[model samples]
Structures are given as C-alpha cells and as structure tokens.
Target: MRTTASFHSYATNHRLVFGDISSDPKTAIAKANTINGGKNGPFRAFIVVGKVFTKNNFEEVNGALQDGSVSVDLPMFFTDGEGLPEDSATNQTDVVDIAPNVTFLNQWGRLMTDDFIIQNATSGSNDRKTAPTDILITDKWPSNLPRLSKVGFAVPQTAERATNNDKTIDATSKDASPLYHFSGSESFWEREPFANEAGKHTRFIGLAPFGGKQRWHYAFTLKKDDTSTPVNATECPYLKEDKVEEEPLKRANEDDGDPMAKKPRIAPSDCFLCLSNPNLAAHLVVSIGQESYMAMAKGPLLPGHVMLIPIKHNPDFCTESRPSTNPRHRHPVRFVSPKLALELRKYQIALKQMHPGGVVFYEIAKAKGVHVHQQAVPIPQEKINNVENLREFFIKEAKECGFRMENNGELRDDQTNYFRIEFPNSDPIVIKLNRQNPKFDVTWPRKLLAQWFFGNKERGDWRNCSQTEAEETEAADKIKGDFETFDFTR
Candidate 1:
C-alpha cells in the first residue's frame, strides 16, 4: 500500500519579537534577520505599519532603505474609513503578518468588496453612501500568487469612499481601491501576496488593514547578517549590542543543596561547565557557536533534551577578558549578547524543527551564581498553542508538592532567581521562585515534563533515568545529525 505524507493545511504566522518600541529601522531589520525555519530557509521581506506609531512615522522604514539592508520598496497606503468623515488619527495595528497562500480562499469564499457598507448603511442618514462591488476568489486559480505583476495580482477595481453613510449618494470616484475588509478581494490588500516559498508566510498574523486606518504600508527584507555589516551604535545611537555590562559570578550558598542554582566565583578554569574543566563530557556536545554551545542533557527528560551553555563560565553569556582595564575590581554581569541570543534562537529553532511538534524551554535564572543554562524538551504539537497553561499547571502541581508558585508578571531579566516557561510562538510564563519557603522543588519542571512526555514521573529525577556514557554519546550523535541543517554554527 502507498501512503501520502500530510502537511499543515496552511502556514502559521510567527511573530518577529522586538523588545520595545524603536524608531530605528536597523534594529527592526536586525530582529527580522533572526527568523529561521518558516517553510522557507530565510525571509526576503518584512513590514512595519504606521498606526500605533505616530502619524506618518516612517523613520525606520526610510532608514531601512538608506542602510541598504533592504531594497527600495513602495509603501501601500490603506484608504480611509467608510464614514461621512473617517477619523484621521486612529490607533490601529495595520502590520499584516501573512500566512502562505496555501489555500485559495482562506475560508473567505467570495466576500464582496463593499460588503461592509451594503450591510450597515442606513437610508436618508447621509447622501454619501457608495455601492460596494464584489471580488471573487477560489475560481480557476494560479499555481502561485502575485502573478507577473509585482504591483498586484487581483487588483481592487472599485471600492467604497471614505465619505459613505447612505441616504443620498455622494459623488464617488470611479477609481478607488476596494474598501479593506476581512473578506473578498479587498482583504487581499492586507496580506499583499508576493510568492517566496513552498509553504508558510514570513509575516506573523497581525490585525488592522481591517476596514479603516490610513497607513502608508512599508516593507523591507533583511540582508544576511554574515554578508552585511552589523548595526553599530554609530548608526543607531542606542544600539544595545554595543553595551558591555558584566557582573561577578557568585559562589553558591554553603547551605544551598541545589547545585544548578549557584556556582563558584572567579573564572572558567574552576567552573565544571567550562571547556577547561577536565570532567566535562565532550561527547555530549551537539554544536558550538562562537560565544555559546549546546550539549545533550546529562539525564534527558526525553531523547532530544539539551542545554544551551555559554562557552565561558559566566551565566549572562558574555565574556570579559580585559577585566584588568576596568576601573572597577569586579566584572559587571552583561545580559545575553546579540550573538549569544541569535545562537540560542538558532539552536531552539533547530530543536523545534527536528521535533515537527514544538519544544518547551524552562530556566532557573539565579543572577549572582550559577552557569545560566536553559533546558529544552520537545512537547506535543497540541500543546504549543496553550501558552498560558504552564502557570496553572505549576500552581496545581505546587500545591500537591507542599509548596507554592507565583504567576509573577512583574519579573524582569535583571531580577535574580525565577522559573520561566517559554515557547517559540508564545509569550513566556515566568514564576518567581520564593526564597523564603525553600519548599519549591528545583526539579519540578523536569518532573512535570517527565509525566507529560514519558508518562512516568520518576524520570524527572535524572538519577532514575540516567543513561550510560555510550548511550548518551549515541543520543547526542542522533540529535547532532538531525540538527545539522538548523545548527547556525555548522
């Protein structure tokens, strides 16, 4: 018997994570360059809308053009709202995160362009109502989208004017772009399809471009960071990459039994996690980047379990060799550097791609002490969307364990000691570990994952599931092979 392999009916939109609002186009481009494994090998274009941003704030969009990170691309401006007078200063999220045009209609069938005005307009109220036309899709379709025309494939022939409120028809222009709506050909303007891959769209799912929001849409692609130069502080004065803030690695408390939470101060030479440590398990190392490395977990909760470790002993993933030059006698703790962050992302994405199902990441970050490393485990595909679940799960499990877990929303990276549950497509759920109780189990995440994955909670204690050195080597080799394409170091 022959069988056919199945694929996701449509592509899923993955959001480009930008920490905060920035007017620098270089920062946005730099962030866009970091996405990997989304139906295509790399994204050729990215978009930034001028809505939630100041009116006509095209600084980053224009900056992207000047930096040569992207080509000169025209901005598509969305028409105004269908009212006697649509508000000019509306706050909207017009940035469209497109999914691949896998399905011809996207369950929208053949919605009309003026469907909104036709259904809602009242008679004798205003003489400015324009009759809406229809746009049909899902008929005879093309093998791909954006036909020969880079401008548009399905052009919006005619549409509703910004001053349309029914009753007496206002003098409408013969040539107007279709009113932006959730259905029909007008909806196509939001996605602005330009074929680039076999499946999946580069843009994450975004709102706005919905009905009304005057926006001059701008899109630009990221240049390969390798070929292009890095965005230095010279370009954007507040470039975070240029900053170097390090802290002294602290020794674990003598009373504390959890070894992962604390470590010795000083240098990599004395740290077990460092390459200089003679007892380090070299065979379990999967891939090593310039600043960071990944290795299979000593006792994996599952087959592909791994740890993202810095090449040096420090937890913050920064290295300071010239400590003597500093006026201060101590090393300031630098947060995750860009290179390290990219490597970490590549590794995490590599694991997620390998699993086909998604992956889960949990970290116990003790700022002052310990080699900060996060443990990743492959989870079922069904669980990937349940982003808020980890908090409730931990709360329930904590009560049974004779302890408590806080759904701490105010936790920041600078703060020490916290448990973080993370997913690729979702916001991380962070729970601050209470220092006073001392009842929190360090291995609680391991145990929970063990129960969910292996159907055996005992495996949470690595001792119970520990493998031989040879077996570990084999597991590492398999993972290394699977991750060959995804590994950025390779």
Candidate 2:
C-alpha cells in the first residue's frame, strides 16, 4: 500500500498517524489495551513504526532512515487465536508504504472505513520529442499564368494517417486535385515515407497538394558514410572454474609460524604471497618476483586477489606502477613492469588451475608508516566455512603446513583456548633482523608477556570489574608519571 500527494489532496501537507509497537513498555501496553477492546476498545489492534537502519539501534531522531521513502518494520506482539486479525485485514487494508511522486489513498482515515472505496489520481507526463524535422521549398511559374512560389509543411507521419485513400494522378492531367503517382511517373507528387521506412516499402502519402504538382521533395535515408552494419554476436566465451586435483601429502618443510609474519606485515597478511618479507627481496628487485609472490597467495584464497604495490609510496589507488612514455602523468617513483604484472597473472592462472579458489587483486597504496609493498589477497570462497567450523579446519591446515602449535588457551579471554602456530622457520630470523634494525621492532615479546599476565582473568573477576578499579587507576597514574619523565628524544 502506498500514498502520494494526489491521493491525499485535501491534507497532503499533514503527517499521518499509524498504530505500532512502542519503544516504551508502558506505551505498548496502553496501545495493546486500546486495540484489544478493553472498555469500548476494538477487539484487535497493532502498532507499526518506520525505522532507518544505521550504526545505532533504532532511535527516534538519529537512527537509520531511508531517504525519499519510508518502510515500516513489522512490529512484534503476543496474541491469542481470537485476537488475530484476518489475513486481508492485516495486509492491503492496514499496512502502508509511502514514497514521493506517487499517488496514494487520500483522506485515508475516512476512506478506509468505507465498505467499497475508490480513489482517483493522475500521474504526470513526460517531455515532448526534440528530433529535427526536414523542410522543402519549391518555385513554379505557370507557363500561361503569373509566376508563383509554393511553400508547404507536413509533420511526416501526422499527414499519412489523415489521408489513407489513394488514387493515381495522370502525369499529363494537371488536375486541380490531390493525386498519387507511381515511382516512375513523370508527374511528381510528394510521398512522405513512414517514419519507419516510410519511403522504401509499400508507399504511403501523408498529404498532397489538392491536385497540385510537387516541384521538390525532402526525404531521409541511411547516412552516406554508414557502411558498416552492426552485427550481433550470439556466440560468447564462457568461463568455468577449473577443477584441481588435490596434491598428495608431501609435507612441505614450511615452518608453522608465518614466514613473513615477523617481517613488516602488509595486507596479504595472512598466508599466500606476502610482499613485506625480505626473503622476497631478490624477487621484488626484479619484475618477475612480484608475480610469483601474488601467485603463492592465490591457491589458498581462491579467485586469487592480489595487488603488486610498488616499493615506493603511492597515495592513489590507480597509480600506474610503470612509467608512461607520455610524461605529463608519469609517476615520479619506481613502478612495477608490465612484464611483472603479466607474470603475476600467469602465477594467478597457475594457482587457479591447481587450487579450489578464484583470484582477485587489490592494491593498498595508503601506507601510513609500514614499508611499501603490494598485497595479494586470496579469497577462497569455496573453502570458506562457518565460524563454528573454522577453528578445526584452520588447525588441520596449520598442522599440515608443519606449523608448531603452542597452546596458549590458558592466556585467553572468555575461557576460549588459544593456539599459536609458530613459523619457527620464519619468526626467529625475523625477530633477529627486527632487533638488528629497530624499524621493525614490534611488540612480540611484550604482547606475549601481556597475554600471559592479564589476557585471562576469571569470569567472576571480569563480572566485578569495579573491584579492580582502584588498582587499575593506580597503575595508570604510575604509567602516566613514567611517561611524563621519559626522554623526549627517541
């Protein structure tokens, strides 16, 4: 059900009231009482309210709202069988959806009560045609009469329907009456072709000078230069996901910890090809390396999504990694080669051919402080499991990858167990390098310490957070003091 201005012509400017469930329990109870026929109340009633979906819960002033239109979210209620309204009563008769520029029930309150009601409304029309029209002029001097020029106009097809009757006019008759002539006839008569191929097929004339000769005529045809006729190709290539044969277990000597995890982590942050690893230094130095990197992540996340970011910072999403021959828009920083992008695509194809996932690519150019690197995200849509099933599958995969797991479940919140898979092959060396170069000095040790110390607190203690407020306050004050006295220079 909808309402427009035309339907409510008498009070189009007023707000309409609707019954609905209320935010307040008391108001809802009152509405329910009134509708349920308590002391002259109706036998049944319900309330509805329109809400906008937004970041917050449905709020009166700030919550979600759909622009230009309003949709009502059906209300909740508790009712006995006898109180249930008939399906028709609850449907077209009661619920209303409204939008702008549409006509709807006018004087709804009074009209709704009518046993059989009809409302009339009109919808507006569209703009008129702006196509150009052709004109023709002719000069004719009768041999024995005074010279005269004839000018006339007809709206092409508008005249055709007006005069359907056709009669041949003799070329030599020179009658003072309208007449039609065949194509080869010497006598000339204006033949306005159908707007739709009017002149070519069966001929039709819209208007003819009453038995007058046609000195000149205007007509439309295919443009002189239009030689190529558009051909619609019914045959198109179809793409189907390639099937992959699962590789036999050959336990990859890969480490359990993320190989590049200890390195500066960029997106493609999960497994697959990571751009931030120094192990990839040789590859990144050349164009081919970037593609190989993108390929690696493609298998695990299907429909491989990868972006080869240049080592240089580019703030734009579409920054070309390659230099353009034309310099006006040439990027100042180094870029990846087309060869590299092609190699990456090849790698993607290889992954797709052997993996269950598809490939997708996205580049992150907005690096705040992290090292510049392109990320390849593999989205294994097929491998995606519900959250409830994710843990077991991920664990199995980690084990298969030879990742050593250290159960840190005791150090988790919500009594949930934690499992850390160590890429022993990757982390120790990364940690060593990070220590040597302070730039990547992340909080691995501190994080572990924090987890061991406070990540897990009994549920009883968590429920009574205020009990530790004083201790937390003191700790914060001490930290603030320590920070205040620390050296300003790093």
Candidate 3:
C-alpha cells in the first residue's frame, strides 16, 4: 500500500521590529524618549539588544514577537561585581557599561539594548588587548561594539536545521512549505494547520509580513489532548463571535423547495451572494463593509437555526483575515466604515443585553466543501436542557424574526433586524430613483429607494414572477448555476 503523508502547518502575521535607516541610533533615541514621556534630545545612554535562535546541539531557548517586536531574555553581557576600567594616561580608554538597560525598537524586531556597552578610553583604546578576556567577545582591537544593527542571529527555517546540531546555522534550510511563511490569506485568529511527522506532531508557524517581503517563523510542539478546554479573553482582540446582531434572512419564500438545496457562491465581480431564489430577499444584518454571517443557533447540525452573512466574514473576533481587493470586487466587509461597524456594535451590545447569560454560536459557512450564507444561531444554555425544546427554540425564533421555515422547520417570528433604506433626510441616491418615474407615487418611491439601496437587486424578479410557483421555479434555476459551497470541518 502506498502511504500518503500530510503535514499540518501553522501561519501567523507579525510586524518586524528592526531594519532600515528608520531604525538608526538617532531615530531610536527619539522613539525611546517619546516612550519614556520625555522630550526628544540627548539621553544619558541608548542601546539595543535581542535574542536569536541558532541551531545548536542543545536547544536552550525559543523566541517570539510581541506587539510588533521581538523578545529574548538571554544572559547579560557581563555579571555584576566586575570592576570598571581604571583611568589611564598613555592607554586611556573610556569603559561604558557592558550591559545597560536601554531597549531599542528596530524594523527587524525590538531589541533590549539596555545591558551592553561601548568601550571609550582616553588612552590608546586600540591597544586594549589588556581588556577582560573572559567575555564571549574579546577584542584584539577596538572594532566590535555591538549595536542594534550589528546584533542579530540567523533563524533557521527548516525543521532539521532548527532542531539539528551545527556550527554554521543555516536559517533558510527549512523546506519550501507554507509553514515557513505566514499565510496572507487567513486572519490572525485562525489557528495554523498542524500535521504529524514520524510519530511527532508539528505545527507550522509563520510571522506577519514586514518591510515589503520578509517574515518570521516558529515551531510549536503540539499537545496530544484533543478535548482541551477553550480559553476566552476579557479584553478580546476580536468581537464576541456569539453576539447576535440581526436574525437570518429567509432563503426562499414559501411555495419554493427546500432552501438548503441551493448552493452559496460569492461572486468575484460585485461581492454579492448570488442565490438560486431571486424571490427570496436577504436582509444583511451588517453593512457591506463589515463581516456578517447566517448560521444555525445551537450547532451547524441543527435544523431551523441559521445565520445571515457579511461578505468579509470572521469566525471569531480574536483573529480575522481581510484581503485587500479592488473596491469594485470588495466584499461588504469594512472595519473602519462608520456607517456599518458602529451599527453592528450596537446590535452585538443589544444581543448580549437581551439574551443575558445565553451562549451565542457562530461559524462561517465557507468551510472546506460547503457554500451557503454565513449564519449564526443564539442558543440559550437553558434551552438546550431538552432536545425537543432546543429544536422548538429555533423554530420559534425563526418565525418571530419573520419568514416561513420548512424541512422539519416552523416559523417563529415575522420581523427581523434587517436595515431598511430610510431617507436620512432625502439622500441623492433616492432622488435619482424618484426622478425616473412620473406616475410613480410618493410611497412607491420610498419603497423603491429602500429596496434598491438596502434590498437584493436579484430579488427584483419578485415583480416579474406572475405566479408564486413561477417565482420559485425561476429562483431554483438561478441558484444552481451561481452558488458556491462552504466547508466548516476545521
């Protein structure tokens, strides 16, 4: 039997800390002064230091980047109790501290330069062959003063090189795989892929891009525990994924076949979700710039529980990836747009308040193989106590939010939180629509504006479909050709 091997790799984005002229000594001093809350000028002393991982027979240390900087707690240059250089006339040499406490932020990475020193003497400093010889670096002359730019260890990229014993460390010997570089395609919160190799589980890790082309790398030894408890953060880097904003928009109107029968596909041209049923309207809870979703409430395996989606969707608030695309092809995912994110925040705050003590579940439908609207379901922990009760909760919620639920589903609500286009004092987009029709009444324009601005353009078929049956048929044909599937296995 031929055995196929698959290795899981991890990717992460981290900013570089030290590199280029911006990281010069003078520039570093200014930044340090600002961080210390002092005016920029001459300081008593300035330094830069860092920890680098080189391939050694005995692995003694590991490194990581924090807050766009590198961190390494290695041994100091020299221990305390060491005597300072004596003042000499003929061989005068100014001995600064071998280890000072100055930290330097560089483009390559942040350095802790506070523990080293520059040797300056009043005598013939070049003749300091008489200086301490026990140091790792002893000078025959005065040519080796380590600084931010001068200090760095080549990080090995290959697993063997990183884990092997060698004098001349080859940092770039790592295999040409995704694990060596960060995946620009994914968000920060998404865990890096992991795979098993020779009875050992290894996780591939990469850093965020810095200075145009370079990135960092790492290796995380994985634990065998499959049922590990989840961790939650207080001041989270992402929004609460469980927070409910707007209830899901219906997939298809009544008289149509099962909604799930249609596939979900994101279009490259407009970022609009082209569905099979045009008669069925989708009211997006979040704006085009914010990530949104439609999914089940208790679990994706559940029935009526569902989520409406945003084009730029995030599974969790901790780490999200948003690719920079052309404005025309961009999904309605925006983090900075005041018109969208602000309202989404309001919805999340409202959901947390309204469903006190309930757990909200979320998942992007864009998993590996499936394609459907990204939806989330809010399941009260108490509701899950009984299996039948849990199912009923989804049914009731779906109806209350408005829309007919089928396939062992029932309606619960009729009104959802979808935004309606209202004249925030008669915008121009509305004026243009009104001028196009003479016989069109005032109420018609208001409705048209709302539908045009906030409603699905494909849903315009609702006006042409004479019979309910015809509308459903037309929608079915539309969805089959355009939808894409989402895979949520991970």
List model 3 lDDT by residue over 1-490, tens digit each. Answer: 2122211111111112221212122333334444333322222232222212123310222111222132222211211111222234212212222223322211111112222112211112211111110001111111111111221323323343233222111111111111111212111112323221111112222222212244321222222222222332011111222111111212222213343322222222212342332322343211222344322221122222234443432211212225446676343222223433454444344334433443232222211112224232233344433323333433343355443323222212221111111111121111111112222221232223223333422211222112233333344333322221221111
Q: What's the residue-level lDDT of 415 in candidate 1?
A: 44
Question: Candidate 1: where is the Cα deviation over 4 Å?
Answer: 1-267, 315-334, 380-391, 399-410, 424-426, 434-437
lDDT of 1: 0.43
Clashes of each: 10, 44, 87
lDDT of 3: 0.24
Best by lDDT: 1
Sequence-dependent TM-score of model 2: 0.17
Candidate 1 residue-wise lDDT, 1-490, digit = tens: 2122212211122212121122343343444454423343232222222111223444444444446655322111111121111222222211121112101112111111111111111123211222222111111111122223333323334342112122121111110111221111222333332211111111111122323232222222321111222222012111222111111112222324343333434345435468786546788888888877888887687788888887767644433333334675354443556776787877777778887767888787654544678788877555656635655675577677655444444455344556677755556665655543355545677878767655667677664455667788899999889888888777
- Model 2 lDDT per residue over 268-335, tens place: 32112334432232221212243232222211111222234433222222224344466764323334
The per-residue C-alpha lDDT of model 3 at residue 328 equals 62
Indicate whether candidate 1 or candidate 3 has the larger lDDT: 1
Best by TM-score: 1
